[model samples]
Target: MAKWGMVIDLDKCTGCTACTTSCGMENNRLPGENWQDVLFYQEGEFPSGTLKWFPRPCMHCENASCVEVCPTRATYKDADGFVLIDWNKCIGCKYCMIACPYGVRFYTDEKAPIQPDVKQVFKGDGQRSWNPPWRAPDSRDDWKHGVGIQPNGVVSKCTFCYHRVSKAPKGTPDLNPANPALREFTPACVVTCAPTARYFGDLSNPNSEVSKMIANQRGVRLRDHTGNKPQVYYLTGGAGGAVPTDRRGKKA
Candidate 1:
């Protein structure tokens, strides 16, 4: 009965974009299709102003707007508190995309390469995310919990790396403080954060790091007026920064 969530310490983030890169490779995202992004904005006067960066991901709201407007129920919240998209059920209507206040969703449109570079992102679990188009006659269908590069015309966004979090040890935090693994038991964005600006844990657990961060740092969610209740929390320190509304993974 764990509700998974993340905390992005804005004070610690350096806008290095390791999270975005890892997410792209792990999820096999295209050039313009960014599931994780660092939203940048400038505030105040030019010379006296400041440049700030906010690493943006899916909010995974308690009452997600995307889920509410999905005509086909393709976008839904899982029992574990993660909002997800069922690719098979998605009808390419773009309703969920419109409903998302963060503007994080992207309509996939033939972004896959003709012959995917092995050096690029994975297409299956063993090799890549899903079998290439050429594998149609004998597609690899056994990759359980699979989410290959989304087909054309479907809107897709971050899933909080649901595939990894689901396998975490029960009752225990996903990323072990004593022995954290960069390539296991965490979302690609969280694990690859070089500065360790991100933290993910079970929010329902009072003792979890995420819960403690929110309590200790007064972590705030984005766009409070929307009443979306984003699970992702931010702790702003130093100068703090403004997040760009169109944070669509503009090449990090």
Candidate 2:
């Protein structure tokens, strides 16, 4: 029942893309498609200008505009309050993409990886053709949940690695059973972060580390004025640093 969330400290982020690569591999995403990305934004005058790197991922907003606009209902809020995509049901209309404030959704123009055809020699089983059973017409239903493939012809985005998090062991009574406490229930990007700038936990629990960090730090959500109520929070600098600004010198 805990509201899962993430906090990223810009101070500790070094712009290394370990997190991005890890997320792609962990989710078996198609090449050039990233579940998370680090973006560089330049601001200020020529003499005093500065470049800042911002890591962007699914905000998992409480009022998710993406979910509201999906005609197929492929995108919906999961029981744990994280926005998820049911790729099988997605029609690839990309309505969700247009509605998303964070630009997290992606559509694949090409087919995902198919099982490679294996060549068999004449001596092997009396000239028998070798092919993975899973790829066989009848076996498709059996291996539906296996890795390295997602349902084709649909939209995709960060699920917070819900499949992996759901499989982690339930540790203690104090923690949510779905995501254990002893083991860090991080999405792939969080685990691969070189600087360990990302932190994930139950934001609903007032005593949780993420909750305390949010309370203690000067955290800000992107485009909060839109009333998206995003769960992701960012800590850009120490208490007195200048507020983050966009390319046009407007507050971000």
Candidate 3:
């Protein structure tokens, strides 16, 4: 079995947010609930100030705190390196939210992150929070893997596009968007990256691009001190898009 992972080259990232847009559309996310987000920060002073952006996604940690704290076992990590949420098992306790150091988890039922709630605009028929008109016809409600539109009370976050990635050809080393055949199985965020900053592949394979990048390019994980051991890695060119010392003041 392949241990899936991602490597992002911050030097190449232009902070275009195309990844964010594609992820929201692909997953039928509500406004302001972005699975892939570009976080901006400023460094230095006055005239010498430098503005940088960090693309934030679920760390998919090997030692995931979310999985550890879930009282209902709603959150789990698989052998293939995916950290997923089982919406059916979830009880809306938000323990996973509090446990996540990345703050990538979301509970849309509480308050609208943006004005003029879209859920109110397009109400769902039953348990679904909203019925998006433009929802993908092929989209499946595999709540076990955290795919599809979330029901009223469950928490949601990035699943490394499990609905699509799970369908990739067996033994495929990398899911490069540039490859026409693999495009269909690639994650929406990786496919839409304008600068080709994102890379996805099996971490266990020493030959995989993701693994080689981490070895050669000096890739780093966010908040690694927490011992979450995030699968996602970043390659900042030591300039723009540098990781924040503290994304939020408080530690998780």
Question: Residue 193, candidate 1: how far off, in angstroms?
Answer: 0.6
Q: List, residue by residue over 6-106, the lDDT tens digit for candidate 2.
A: 88888888888788888866665544566787776666678987776678888999999998998978788876767887765777798988999888877
lDDT per residue (tens digit) for residues 1-252 in model 1: 889999988878889988888888777766556789887776556588677777899899998999999998888888888888877787889988888888888776444444454323435444333444333233422122225556545677888877777778878654643355424778888878887888989999998889998999998988867999999998887645444434434575
Could you estimate the TM-score for every candidate? 0.81, 0.75, 0.95
Instruction: Rank the models by TM-score, top first.
Output: 3, 1, 2
lDDT of model 1 at position 90: 77
Query: How high is the lDDT of residue 158 in model 2?
Result: 79
Question: TM-score winner among the candidates?
Answer: 3
Estimate the lDDT of model 3: 0.90
Candidate 1 regions with alpha-carbon error over 4 angstroms: 110-146, 177-183, 240-252
Q: Regarding TM-score, does 1 or 3 come out ahead?
A: 3
Candidate 3 lDDT over 31-80, as tens digits, reads 89998999887776679878888999998998999999999999999777
Of the pair 2 and 3, which is ahead by TM-score? 3
Residues forming the 10-long window of minimal summed lDDT in candidate 3? 243-252
